[model samples]
Target: MTLGTHGEAGLERGRVDLQRYGHALMGTYGEPMRVLARGEGSWVWDADGNRYLDLLGGIAVNALGHAHPAWVAAIAHQAATLAQASNFFATEPQIRLAERLLELAHAPHGSRVFLCNSGTEANEAAFKMARKTGKRTVIALEGGFHGRSMGALSMTHKDAIRAPFAPLLDTVVFVPRDDEAALRAAATEHAADLAAIIVEPIQGESGVRPLAQGFLAAARELTRRYDALLIMDEVQTGVARTGAWFAHQLYGIQPDVMTLAKGLGGGFPVGAVLAFGERVGSLLAKGDHGTTFGGNALAAAAANATLDVIEAEHLLDHAKAVGEHLRAGLEALDGVVEVRGAGLMLGVGLAAPVSAQVAQAAVAAGFIVNPPSPDTIRLVPALTLTTAEADLFIAWMAEHGTRITTEGTTA
Candidate 1:
């Protein structure tokens, strides 16, 4: 519904729903934000009938954007045909999606893929696989966010959360993000006991900072030196978010193991871990690990359909072109410290700690944006976003950026 017919009533109803949501739901995320009702393309309509240009793209999950025909059709068709089955049974879409990912990743012929429900679960599976290697220690970068589950949380290097879950397995080492010296020292210090070294091609949560090519190469070298697995956590940067099927494509360096999610199933919940080459691929035998609803038919079909749309529509090239436009425009703005990232995944750095205010003002002005930190605004808009739409947000930033930043805001 647009704003014309149901403006005030819809908003009131939405507020009521939010109140109900507060009492009925757990308070993990605190109060409700927006009672988003529906979406299409790069726009979403709230229950209040207000419209928003969705620049956040549901935190990089909606690769194809809202209500894409192909995405809807795939899920509907799969649900009508065969929605799910036991792990004991295999489905066509599940197998096809797995094969397609391996092919896109350019993994070896016999490489393996493990499917799960979300990025965290994918990381959990990767963590279990790392443990199976018999090495007691694993190294991960600081500011890296894997997931919230116990094991994934251990790998996640957040002091605020990690402190609460202290004295974890103590098997994971945290290296400063993008610190070449720290990485080398950690790798050297724990080289013998290292099971795997997990790094994000682009740090998503802490900030949208892409790891340097040389740093990625160094991590690969360190892993190889200790005979440890190099695992790339491309959960946020994979599935064409970074102008490539995988962000690792930009580096031209391959990891022995890779975790992917976010856009894997477009809007559906699906995650995967692909183990490259023969030896690592064969690590998880029959009963060694399992998933009940990881690669169910519906989610797999959605993923397969998302892949087809990405290729057929040539969104990758579109992302590159439009991303340049967005970045250049944002960088030209006052107070914009820098803009970093490839394709639709971009982080806008500000001179002061005003990202939260910027994001709030953007949303209030009818745009959806995110503050990853006090100083960085993240934009992971839908790949389907048009250059015109990007220009619209750019104009908004140019006009309101300074004023919006000075005001402490929330959306």
Candidate 2:
């Protein structure tokens, strides 16, 4: 169907679409802010025909931005050739994608990849791998977000979300992020039963807070000492989102296991669990785990194309440069206190608890961003976001920053 047509017709279409959406869908997400119709590089148009700079990049899923030509072509070609073949048989794209991931990750010999369809599924697989260790305890960080599924939610630290799902796995322990002492203490206490210590290199949901280098080193050391796995949840920070191919690479630490999604598929739905070394690779035996559509030809082709485009377009360097540009701009804004994170994954800290207001104002002014916390605005825009696009948001913030924050306070 034609979407984003201009004028009152578009407005009417949007309204009708929203009404239908409300009636047909679950309210788990409350309400979608807009009926986005179509998208291109760094921008999207709603059903109402309003254009917006998509700085959120579908929450960092669109690594190549919306509708990248190469990514689209790969998917199209693969779909025509072969899309799905159950786990009973594997395809060339699937095998090649796994090899590519191992090479990009610099995984050691005997390393393996388990492909899946989303971040939660990848985390779930990791959880099972941890369980396969014959140990019961896992140490996770406070304010960390793994995913919404039962297995992932158990390891997640959010109380509100977990409260409803009472009786989550009790063996998991929570430690404060970057608190090396607490982490060491927990590791020592749970040494015998410790299966793994899962962490996000940068806590995306908790305001893009990166784990201290020393703390990550400590986790690595402790996990080794206790013979437990170190799982880095790079779902939000992998695939060149953080300038580096993976955030852990920046710290010079390698995880025994790494979970990836988001940008891996570059807008297509795909996830992966990389098990380092032969020992970790054999954690899940045949019949231990399976998926119907994971790493299907189409998904693998999309991901391969994404990695290809990222390299060909030199997006790693571009992300770093544009990210620095955006960070400086955000930090220079009137109400912005600081900017945290690397590459396109940024959190704009505000002087007041008005990030929600700022995000609202941003969208109204034709930019799209999100407030992960009351005082932090998250910007996980596409790797393709240009300095020109970033400057537009920056300029708008410069003009309206103080007013939006003030209005939020008065309201």
Candidate 3:
């Protein structure tokens, strides 16, 4: 199949690909909505050559958007030069990536970075770090999602996903989101055994819900008082996605440990754990943890390239301005109740529980969005997305919002 092929031949190819996908892949994600063939910037083309604006940005992973020139060139260069090296050896890209992350994070002296392959792995490492404190209990907020791996899953709050995998790490406790009193009470009750408190500054899975400043302040104070680590899971909100380098920076709170992925590698798979100071940095000593493909040359090159592009292009300010434009546009629509979140990460709150239907209609209208909850439509578009591109979606919503919300379909 050629890159720009279309028409009847393309449609037939798409049908065959979907059939193959059904037969060859697991049912974990049910079925993909479309057989995507290629992407550039904020747009993706299906196998049938139909294009759609990718508002979800691979669920907040593609910070530079798809097939970015610099990102692609960097990966190609690294792959040709030196792709992999075992943990026994260290490569330049790997070391440089770690240094860059620490520098970008403004880590104090003795801070450290541990690079891994996915958000789950980063959180799993974090779970071990908490356990290293010789404590057994950890606190996570209700409606918060860490990752799908066993250890990360243990920290997640949803019952449906967790119930299937019984006998998880029983040491973790859940608290209501943004409820300072509950968090304080939980910390006090478990102070003796509290290893850490893991939180998402803005909970992405439940909806783009930001934790209140006061709530975050309380968590910081309580953790300090209890001598427990404050772990920030910035897997979705990190890497300039929220206009800030990290979401916690927005509130002027620094966590002892921070987990990052998604946009870190732009589209390549990479995750990292940033230890803030000497105390937390030394938790995972030599041989305490390890990974095969964690910070290999190729992955590090990709991540470094992603960070480079974000800085050179001034994407941080771009995200902030475009995000505000989107928020204002959505809020002006008839069916929208409000807009939540910061930067390019936003949730359009609807006046009715019709987000699923609206999202479906959006795809039909050549846009891609996600309904994380029935009342919220998530927009985590590429940081490079322009205001003009955003207006296209805003226009669509303005034209179809009334019918989709009330009638459950655009047609």
TM-score to true structure, per model: 0.96, 0.97, 0.97
Best by lDDT: 3
Write the residue-wise lDDT of candidate 1 on 1-411 in tens digits: 111333345478788989999989999887756789899999998887788899999999999999999899989998999998978899999999999999999999789999988999888888888888888788998889998888999999888887887777788998887788999998899878899999999998987998888889999999899989999999999999989999999999999999999998999999999999988998888898877898999989999999999999999999889999999999988778899889999999888898877776676668888999889999998999999999888888877865565444332
TM-score of 1: 0.96
* Candidate 2 whole-model C-alpha lDDT, 0 to 1: 0.91
What is the C-alpha lDDT profile of model 3 across 166-208, one tens digit per residue? 8899999999999999999999999999999999999999989
lDDT of 3: 0.93
**The 10-residue segment with the lowest total lDDT in model 3:** 1-10
Cα deviation of 301, candidate 2, in Å: 0.6
lDDT of 2 by residue, 231-254 (tens): 999999999999999999999999
Query: If the candidates were sorted by their TM-score against the true structure, best first, what order would they fall in?
Result: 3, 2, 1
Please give me the total number of clashing residue pairs in predicted model 3.
0
- lDDT order, best first, reads 3, 2, 1
List of clashing residue pairs for candidate 3: none
Q: By TM-score, is 1 or 2 better?
A: 2
Superposed on all Cα atoms, the candidates' RMSDs to the truth, in angstroms, are 2.3, 2.7, 2.6
Candidate 2 residue pairs that clash: none
